[model samples]
Target: MEADPRWIETPDDGELADRLRQGGEAVRAELKKVIIGQDDVVEQVLTSLFAGGNSLIVGVPGLAKTLLIQTLSEVLDLSFNRIQFTPDLMPSDITGTDIIQEDPDTGQRKLVFMKGPLFANIVLADEINRTPPKTQSALLEAMEEKQVTIQGRTYGLSAPFFVLATQNPIELEGTYPLPEAQLDRFMFQINIDYLPEDEELEVIQRTTTVAGEPPQAILSAEAIAGFQHLVRKVPISESVARYAVQLARRTRPGRDDAPDYVRQYVGYGASVRAAQYLVLGGKARALLRGEVNVSFDDVRSLCAPVFRHRILTNFHAESERVTTDDLVKQLLDDVKPPKSGM
Candidate 1:
């Protein structure tokens, strides 16, 4: 298999950096056992994990989105849970609830907190958009705070908790689109497209040939948490950070720095969180590839996944058949990085 383009040679620092890079390579190696292609999607998913954030995977059905996430969790050795979200799915169903159970010896009853699927280290929220907002809101607390509150009591989730949510973009009927607030919590809006004809043929051949073997675990939960900290420590020069911030700020239609396309096509621009994720995701990307520090290219490379969902297009753009990705691409072309090198 061809290596990911971003994993070029670069000097790494410390034992942790070396481990992070090796771990990444090992993961890709293992994932190839069953997965046919989608290297970019896999990279973004790993970047989100290393950055200690969640991701929303958008794709058409039969793309193996669920299988990809399930395989990832297995290879990472994290506890995995899959929740099939529907309109009737309740908050308590996801977050668990306090149930009154009687003690056999004492004959006493009290509310006991029962852990739900959200308690796992890695949660696959399948068809997340199919659920109502009220039920979806249950994840907000756990996703942001790493804890769930039930019956006036909050319980902390296990460390290295990551949610990989998948939604079928083509299936909008009877679906409750995720609210902006919930969408913002996600670190990336990963878009998965059709694989190459060759790869698709290989996928067909493999599935028809034999029962596939599963990927081996590469990193433990504690190690993953440690690598997450290491990613945060990946330094970036202020100029590069400013460039990322400016890029995100320019997405806003009301901002002075926003380009004419943004003003005409977009209803709203990205938020400060967009800038934050750019830096964070860039840092993780840099670390994975053995880059010593974050770069302007790192920030730019993540623009589509980081800003696409955050930037909301207006009616004019929709009518004109323009997408947020189109606007972001134009924005990238117009924006330039600082002259100074780190």
Candidate 2:
């Protein structure tokens, strides 16, 4: 499918970009009615949605991780399903099972496939780490391929399918750490923190005093799919593209171009996917800001989300309290943009 040509530079470019910006802002406002704070978290989630990628939200329990996914489905007017991962959960539990039943017309018994909760448009894999590796692997096919094979038959999921998986950062007992392979499927592993003092107070007041209804549907599934398509129409300059690649490459250790801190503290660097997401995310951000083309600021703002999941730190770095966030910040500070009018 081709992107909308109207998004390119034209006489009505300013007005059209403004409309797209308002559309995004409207979605955020609708979400805020139910979600209290975490505007940054909401934006990142929205960006992933518009970028057509899955998100892995990591936060302590009671941070509204499930609620956030639920609210997003409501606002987007998409089908939402939640699967609570447990130790005894099996692969069939997530990907569906085959049941033997007699045919309606014939006396012969045949096996029929029963679809699982993963068939929905938006799936919330709540406490994903609680499940064993075998059970978790069931989602790998669905997440990456957007389809599940059951009983030798594959069923394709609905369009705009997104998996919002959540994990408890504090819990370790009875939890299976996600393998690196599955982790790579996630576009962004966002860390959701506790709400601010004032935001917590507001949340209590809003939910307690009034009859807090769910958020109103701001955009239909079709509209959301359309917006995702529109994001691709946003242009990205070559310079900004090169900057994204350079930032991702600098994460590697023992490279001639590697910064001193990266070689000292970094164990592993971001993969090529990091650079791809950086540009795609930059396009979405540019569209959000009423711009047809991406700028340096757009790429810079998205550095954290793009590289956070890709960079791996060592024991020494962890002991020094250095995090992926710190590495990303250093990259942004060290990388200089090309000067204009030079």
lDDT of each: 0.89, 0.84
**Per-residue lDDT over 193-231 for candidate 2, one digit per residue giving the tens place of the 0 to 100 score:** 989999999988887886666566666666566667777
TM-score of each: 0.95, 0.91
Candidate 1 residue-wise lDDT, 21-60, digit = tens: 8889889889899888999999999999999999999999
lDDT of 1 at 98: 85
In candidate 1, position 97 carries an lDDT of 89
Q: What CA root-mean-square deviation does each model show from the true structure?
A: 4.2, 4.2
Q: Which prediction has the highest TM-score against the true structure?
A: 1
